[model samples]
Target: MKTSHNFKLTAAAVMLASALLTGCNQANSSTAATKADAVVAIPVEAVLTRQGQISSSYRTTATLEARAEAEVISKATGIVQKILVEEGDKVTVGQLLAVLDNERQQYSLNKEKAELSRLSSELKRMEEMYQRQLISADVFEKLKWQFDSLQASVSLAELALKETEIRAPIDGVVARRYAKVGQLVNQHATQSLFHLVSNQQLEAVVHLPEQQLAQARVGQQAMLQFAGMTPVNAELVRISPVVDASSGTVRAVLKVANAQQQLKPGMFAQVQLQFDVKTDALLLPKRALMSTDNTQTVFVIDSEHKVSRKQVHLGYQADNTVEILSGLELGEQVVIAGQSALKDEALVNVVTVRQF
Candidate 1:
């Protein structure tokens, strides 16, 4: 009976051990299957890196100005007989703009002409006498001198009469009209009679930091922006040789063409001065740039769709593009979207690929 009982106990112990082993095997298989079916590829949006042109630009505030601007003043003193032009009148060069009273000037001119004619007749008679030895050489010379003086007086009087009409000195719009009909004006007047400006040729004047003088140069491209207006294209035309002592800034002038007359003088503008241009530069979308601890980083996707963190040196930045000085290559895929949750060596499925 003791033997039989020991056998039963040993049999029961073996059965329990077999059951535990089977359960352990099933658990191992399930865990293996779960591991094999785990998700690996993270969804991301990427762009192919490329070599392109990039510009290093400096942006500064500026003012739009007419290339040609002047204040017109009268050269003759007289009453403003007829104000031919009003404010905002467009006039061509030498177009009559105003007329002054010229009764006194015309009368004086006529009198001078009559005197000159008389002098010429007298000089002719005296010359004939001298040729026939009927007059003294001294008398003939004196008469000739008198005739020349009278001729000069006539010319002066004619000029005075011509000055009665005021003409536009340049092709432009009359920005302001300061004189009216019957108004007395003089050559010595301090104030101008008209303000003229040409919109055909425009300019953008910007004051930049003195230190940027070294980078500034003529012929570089510029962009002029104003509120509610399309941007105007311009080029750098002038740079101050000396810095402004009070402001510690340098004045830079950009030549602009306002053929449509859209840009006007004294309009506030925002200027982007493209000082430097780089061609065939390695470039990436700006969205791919990630900043951490003041460091710029980007994720580079390899052929296996695995992403790796890369530190890059930045150069010129234009719009939505950035120049990569180092740590990237052409044709490499850069993760621009869904980068916030990326990890090093993480697999990614590029759901969308954008052209550079």
Candidate 2:
């Protein structure tokens, strides 16, 4: 009887402990289920579309050049007697650039002149003799040819003497000086006496990609920015029809009037070309853009309090806002903040929206 009672009491204690453990497990599972039903919500900002012009501008680099440039060289071989203009000197057309030793050329001119005089006197005597029937017609004709030939020689000698003095071919500033006094210049040599650039009008040479070719044309206005000078107005002067094979770019020239002569050639410059203009377009802050694998995407809040991923096509961006080309509509809510933790189809609760 005692063994029977002890067995019954031990069985009762084991059954109670098992029931307690099962109840505890059921309560824990219920608690976990309740916590899992809770929905997480994210805060975001939204924007509305409005009517305003948005410009798409492309920025490019360019170099300043003179509208007109010339390399002054000696046409005739001679020793430079004097250099009248130095580098950086402003000169006009026909101004003396350098003087060459012309003793030999001068002597040649004098000899030609004397021969021409003698030929003219002889031709006069021949004409008189022919009229008086003292000389034949053929002889007079021969003397006339001789006189004309001598006259041409005199003119050639005079031109050679004039070439001994180098002159500025254009009105410009002497940008470089290559020859000095007493230096012998060769006619066929590659060396130039001076480099002149017209500063009255400056040009900026810019390389444009194929996409920008349509927007660039002659007479279009543009803005030029240099390192030290203020922004200047420029007009498109020329454009190359062919694209460079290696670079795939087209060349464009912008003409800028340098009335003050402050702009110089070879200076670096920045060029801005404006293209499309949208009067009404949906714009979102640039910070709102989310990109993955170079594919741009954005997060939007749907009507069901769920987050959804949206792919968007963007256009010109300015003032921190990007133009939405497609995949988004006006008055749609976009996740601008707390997007890092949100996933697709996740539930959201709007805390507040940013007003812009």
lDDT of candidates 1 onward, in order: 0.89, 0.84
Cα misplacement distance, residue 98 of candidate 2 (Å):
1.6
lDDT of 2 by residue, 95-143 (tens): 9989999999999999999999888888888888899999899888888
In model 1, which residue pairs have backbone atoms overlapping below 3 Å? Answer: none
What is the alpha-carbon lDDT for the whole of candidate 1? 0.89
Candidate 1, which segments miss by more than 4 Å at Cα? 1-44, 291-295, 338-343, 346-351
Q: After superposition, how far is residue 108 of candidate 2 from its true place, in Å?
A: 1.9
TM-score of each: 0.84, 0.71
